[model samples]
Target: MEVVKELKVPIDYLFDVFEQSIQSDILAQTGKKLNENEFTGFEYVKDFSKGNQATIQIEKYERNRAYYYSTHTDKNKISVRYDVHSLDEETSKLHYSEEIISNGFLQKMNDALVGLVWGFLKKKRFKEMLNQIEQSYTE
Candidate 1:
């Protein structure tokens, strides 16, 4: 699955926000609903400022794109990439693509049964991250 949004910030600024968000608990709270504990390993990293947690990795970074991967303990993994396309010096389009992969039979069943809700929650988190970046632009 994939999620995309148009952000009104420069690509450079988006990268900065991403780096900042990872360093804090913002990423730990990504895709967080009112009371869900489905996501793990995003918090408590020894050096999240570098974006490598127990189950998350940030890589393939360039001027306009970055890839992030996160895994749940039960063999469910999410690989997502952010592509930023500059429209002008001050605006850019953010395209987020994600793929869910699992090697466990239980995980596959879970995905088939609750994937839609999970996708919605993840999309909500992506928007929240964009909002965070936009807010930081004002500050």
Candidate 2:
């Protein structure tokens, strides 16, 4: 899945927001504080309801440009990337993409059906979050 949005915020401000959000999430999940230099190769486990958990690793990090990460779980491996491009001094384009790979044949078949519904909901929620960020800057 992929999405692209033009944001009203400057590239630098958007990237700062994105970076701070990730840093806050990491600190909340792992109780470890990390600076930008420590982002690449950092690994942590994120727990979900019902005891489900995934190990997340930062695979790529480029300040104000790109952030890519992967999550590994028993059933699937998921990769997510966010790329930011400057459109003007006060505008930016964000490209977001996610890819999921199932671990087994049965899981793959099951994911095909489940992914459709979940992906739609997830995309919607993500778009709303982005819109909120954009709105915050304008306000």
Candidate 3:
């Protein structure tokens, strides 16, 4: 299953929110915590090094993008990549996409379930994130 979402926010402020929200100890402000039965939590595992594959769990953010590795209790790992586009110094667009590979049956099921769940969850998260960005900067 592939999920995509986009949001418009201030470039600098949005990056700041991205940095803060993905902190190791910070639960996603969106509050979409994974079930402990499926996955206990996430952690920053690896990053873009000299020449190697990057890990998903965002340990720390430097430039504009953050990667997070979500691990399941069964040891399944998936990468969630966040791409930020600066429309202007004060405005930016955030695009997030995730690819979940599963069996044909499970994939179909995921597609159906995710349609209902992801839309609600992703939109809610994006709105709250934009609000936080605006608040962080305006105040």
Which candidate leads in lDDT?
Answer: 2
Q: Candidate 3 lDDT, tens digit per residue, 11-81?
A: 66665555454542334332444332322234433433564432344433434554444432222344455
In angstroms, the error of model 3 at 49 is 33
Candidate numbers sorted by TM-score from highest down: 2, 1, 3
TM-score of decoy 1:
0.67
At residue 71, what lDDT does model 3 achieve?
30
Structural RMSD, model 3 = 10.8
lDDT (Cα atoms) of all candidates against the true structure? 0.63, 0.90, 0.51
**What is the Cα-based lDDT of residue 95 in candidate 3?**
59
lDDT of 3: 0.51
By descending lDDT, how would the candidates be arranged?
2, 1, 3
Per model, state how many residue pairs clash. Answer: 0, 0, 4
Better candidate number, 1 or 2, judged by TM-score: 2
* Candidate 3 vs. true structure, TM-score: 0.51
